[model samples]
Target: MPTAPCLQTILALVPRKRAFAASNCRHASLTGGTTIIQAGQIAWVRSACPAGSGPCIFRVLPLHRDGFSIPVTDTPAGNRGARRGSGGITLDDVARLAGVSAITVSRALNTPERVSPDTREKVRLAVEHTGYVPNLLAGGLASNRSRLVAALVPTIAGPVFLETIEALTDALARRGYQLMLGQSGYGESREDALIDAIVGRRPDGIVLTGIMRSEGGRRRLLASGIPVVETWDLTPTPVDMLVGFSHEQVGEVAARFLMDKGYRRPAVVTGDDHRAIQRRTGFERAFAERGIHGVPVFTVPAPTTLGSGREALRALRLAHPELDVLACSSDVLAHGAIVEAHAEGLSVPRDIAVMGFGDLAFARDAHPAITTVRIDGTGIGRQAAAFIADRAEGRAFGQKVVDIGFSLVERASA
Candidate 1:
C-alpha cells in the first residue's frame, strides 16, 4: 500500500467550506508530525513538488483575506496532551493513591494557592507516584489575572524553543507569572497580528521567540510601552531590551570547530531565517579565512524539525557525500541527520561528522550526543525578565544588548 504523505493528510483534513474562511486561525508544526490549528478555516493547503523523494506540505493560514480558519476545541492537558482518554491511569487514581479528595488533588495540582500547605505537599507526593497532570483550563476561572503570560513561539511542535520556553515559564511563575502559549510558524504577518491581539489583552510582558519583525510591528511594540523582550536572536538596535547571542557567531564557531576537527569539506543545512543566514555568512567567511573555497549549502524553511534535517542530509549526500562534516542550523535537523544516517547504513562522525546549533534535550539524548553550539536561552529569558521588571518599576537600564555567549559542546556526533 502507498503511504499517505503529509501534504495529502493536510489536504484531506482541511475544511474547504466557506464557514471556515477567516484567517484568525493559527497553525503550529508540532513534533511527532502533528499540526494544530487554532480555531480557523482551512485556507489553501498545497504541497510543493519534491526535487527528489522527500515531500513537503506548505499551508497558508491566512490571517487576512487569503487563508481560512478552522474551529479548535479546548485541548486538555497532562500526559494525554489533547489526546483522547488513556484508561490505564488518571488524576482520580492519583487522588485515591494519595488519600485525598479528587477536588483536593485538583486543588493541589492546579492551584496550590487555595490549598493548605500540608494538603499541597500530600498531593505533590501522589502526583509524583501516579504521574497525574492537572487540567489547566479545568476549574472555573478563579482569579482576575490568570497570572498567564502568553508567549508566541514560531512553533512549539518543533523543539528549538522548548528549553527557552520552559525556562521563561518557570522564571515568570517564580515571580508569579503564568503562561499562555501560541505558535507563529514562520508567519511574520500573522505573528504581527497575533502580537497585536496579545498586546491588546495586556499580557504582563510579551516574549518574542525571534528578533526579526515587520515595520508596523516595530512601531506598535515601541509605542506599547509594555515590558517586551526579544529572545533567540540579537540586534544592536533593539525594540526594548535584548537577550540572545549572535547567530553569526554560531556559524563562525561551527566553521572553526569543523576546521579544528580536521575537516575541510564543510556543508551547511540551515533554516531560512535572518539569524541562520548570519550563521551561514559567518561560517563561509571563516572558511574563506582558512583558505578553504567552495562551501556547500542546503537551505530549508524555518521551524527546522527532524524531518527537514533528514531531507537536508539526503540532498547533501546526493550532491557531496564526500563532504566531511554537516553543520545544521538547529538540533532538530542534526537529530534528523542522525536518523537518516542509520537508515542509509552510514556511521555518524565516521562517514560524516554532524554538528547542530541548539543544545536541546534531544541533542544530548540522541545516539552519539550531537556536538553543538549551546546558547543560554534560559539565561536570556531570566535576564530579559529582570530587565523588564526593573524597567517597569521606573528603574534605569542602560545597555540594550546583552550578549549571552555560545559554547561548543563536544559529543560523539562531531
Candidate 2:
C-alpha cells in the first residue's frame, strides 16, 4: 500500500465538526497525532494541535501514487470555480485529461482537419469522458462570428407564419448558421425589449417579421451594425434589407375581387394587430374610392383564434344583418366564420361570401374551399435568409427591398 503524501498547507479550511462531513471522509474523528481520511481519489490529512491551542487543521490533497502533484488553486468559499463551459469542465481540463496542450484541444475540436487522427481521437475520448462542451460565445468573440441568426415573430401559436419560420430555419441551417427565435407578441412594446436583448448578444443577423415601428428599436438595430432582414409586411423605409409584400395591396385587391363578383355591402372581420390594421385601412380605402363608404369593420384581438372568428361573425351579423361579404384577417378566422355561418343555416357564397388572408393548408381543404390572398411566405423566408447570409459574409447583394407580391386564389368560399 502506498503511503499518503504529507500535506503542507490547507487548500480549504472547515470547522472541526463539519470538516469530515464536508470532505465526505470515512474517518469518524481525528485520532493520534495525524489522521488520514480517504474519500474517493482525494485524501484529507488532519494534524492534531495542542490541547487548547486551536482546532486541528485538515489539508485536502488528491491521492497520486506516481508522486506527480497536480496544482490546486484556492477558490472562493461556496463557489466551485467559474463554470464557463458545460458541467464545470473547461478546455484546460479536457486538454489535461487528454495529455495535450489547451490549444491542441481547441484545434482538435474546432479545426479537426489540422489535427492528426490520433490526437483528435484522444481529445474526443477525453471530451466524452469529461462531458465537456465548448463555449461557443467565447469562441465567437475571438472569431467575431457567432454563426447565429435571430428571428422575431409576433406569435408561434398561429400557423400563419409557420411557412416563413420553417423556410428561414432550413435556409440558415444550410449556410452553417443557427437561428434563435424570439416571440415579440402582437404589440410593439414586447418587440422593442426583444430587439434590445438580441442586439446585446450581437448575432450575425436578425430577421424581423415586420418593419420596425419604434424609432428607438430601429436605432438600436442600426447602431449594432448587424445584418437585418425585415419580412412579411413591406415599407419603403426598412431598417436594412426588406423581403415582403404590401398588406395594403392585399386588402385593396381583395376589395376589388369582391366588387367584381357583384358583392356589395362588404364588411371586414380583422384583428387589431398593426399589420391587420394596415390591411383593413387598405380595404376601407379601396371601397371608399369606388363611392362606397362605411364598410362595417369588426375588430378582434390579435393572434385571432377560431373561437374569436366565430364570435366576430356572430357579432357582425347581429350588428349588420344586410352585410353580404366578410373578409377575414386570417384563414383560422375565416374557417370559424364558415362554421358559424353553417350553424346559422346559411349557405356560403349563396347567402354570404367569405374571403380569408394567408392561404393556410386548411383553407384549401375546408367544407367550401376558402378564397384567400396568398402571400409567398416561403419566398419571403428564403429571400430574408439570402439577404442575411450575403450581408454576414460581406458579399454585395443588389436589391435591398424585394416585394414578392401576393395572389388572390379564387375558391368556392368566395
Candidate 3:
C-alpha cells in the first residue's frame, strides 16, 4: 500500500529543545526573587515577600516543567541557628538519623542485596520518616542516559496490543531499560505531542506500536538518535526495525478460505483501525474475483467490543438475510457474532459460518470454538527484541522482511 513509505525519510523532523528552562524562568518571575529553582537545582535568595516581624511562612511553588518545587523562607540572613541548607532533608541526614554510614544508606536504597536485611529495613524506615526524594534529574544529567525507554501505543484499552506491550516491557527490562508508556489515543496530533515530550526526555530507546506518524514527529524521532522499533503492522521500509504481518495478506487469505468453503454470500465485520481498513480493502478486492457485489460489510468503532460484533451481525441479517458467512477482524468480535447468531436461533457453521483473525487465548475456548488465523505474537516479540539488540550492539542485521507466516486454525465455526 503506497509502497509502505520510507521508514527514515518519512519522519525526518528537527529536534526541539527541552521546554523546562523557559518554564522555570516564567515560574521564577511569578514567584518574586525568593529562590531560583531549575532542573534539579534549588537556590535560596533574599525573600521578596512583604517583611513581617514574626517568623515568615515558607512558600512552596511547584515548577511544572522542571518537576521540582521552590521553597522560600523569611528567616533573617544572619540569624542564629537558622536552617541554611537545601529545602529537603539530605541523604546524609537520613543516614545519620538511621545511625548508618552514608555509603551503607546509598547501598541500601540502590542495591539492597549487598547490605544486611536488617540494616536495609532500618535505612528504608529512616528515609520514609525524613521524606527524602532522590534527585533523578541530577542523576540523569550526570549519566546523559536516562535508562528509560519510552513506548507509544495507539491505545491501551484494546487487547490486540497487550501481548506486544508485555513482551516489549520484558525484553527492555532484560537490557536494563525501564519502559515509560504513553497512550496516544488514536489521534495524530496527540501522538506528535507525546513523541515530542518523550524525545525531550532523551530515552535510551523508543518503541512505536505502528509505523504511521506525523512528519514533524518523525523528524524529531530521527534527530533524537535513539533506537526505534515499530511493531504490530508491517512496511517494506521501516524507520528502524519492523515486527508485524501484513493486514492485506490476512484479508486475502480469509476471503480465499471463505470462497473455498463454497460460501456464496460472505459479509465482514471490521473495526475502524487503519490496518483493519486495509484488510477490508484486500477482502473486497479478493471477493470481487468471485463476482460478489454489495457484499454487505459492517464497520464498528475501534477497540472493538463483543457488542459491536453482535450489532454487526444483526445489521447484516436485516440487510442481507442470505449472508451465510461472516469474517471478523478479531476473535473478540467473532465471539460476539457467534453469540448474536445463537440469539437469533441460528447454529454456527450449520446455519451461519464465521471466521476471525487473531487466534487469541479465548478463540478455542468458545462453545463452538472459533476458526481463526493464527499469528505468533510472541515470536514477533522475540524477533523485535533481536532486531533492537542487534542495532544497539552495532551488529549487522540483514533481511528486513521477516514473514513469520500465519496459519488458519480451523475449528467448528468455519
User: Scored by CA lDDT, what does every candidate get?
Assistant: 0.70, 0.80, 0.72
- Quote the positional error of residue 296 for candidate 3 in Å: 2.0
RMSD of every candidate to native, in Å, equals 20.9, 8.0, 15.1
Q: Which candidate comes out best when scored by TM-score?
A: 2
| Model 1 Cα shift for residue 26 (angstroms) | 52
Model 2 weakest 10-residue run by lDDT: 62-71
By the TM-score metric, which is better: model 1 or model 3? 3
User: Which residue runs of candidate 1 sit more than 4 Å off their true CA positions?
Assistant: 1-148, 395-398
- TM-score each candidate: 0.63, 0.76, 0.69
**Deviating ranges (above 4 Å) for candidate 3:** 1-135, 389-401
Q: Candidate 3, clashing residue pairs?
A: 11-218, 11-219, 12-219, 13-219
64-139: candidate 1 lDDT, tens digit per residue: 2323222232222222443243323356655665678778886676568999998888888656544456554333
Number of the predicted model whose lDDT against the real structure is largest: 2
Candidate 1 local lDDT, residue 380: 78
TM-score of 2: 0.76
Give the TM-score (vs. native) of candidate 3. 0.69
Candidate 3 per-residue lDDT over residues 323-363, each given as its tens digit = 89999999989999999999999999999999988888888
Q: Indicate the TM-score of model 1.
A: 0.63
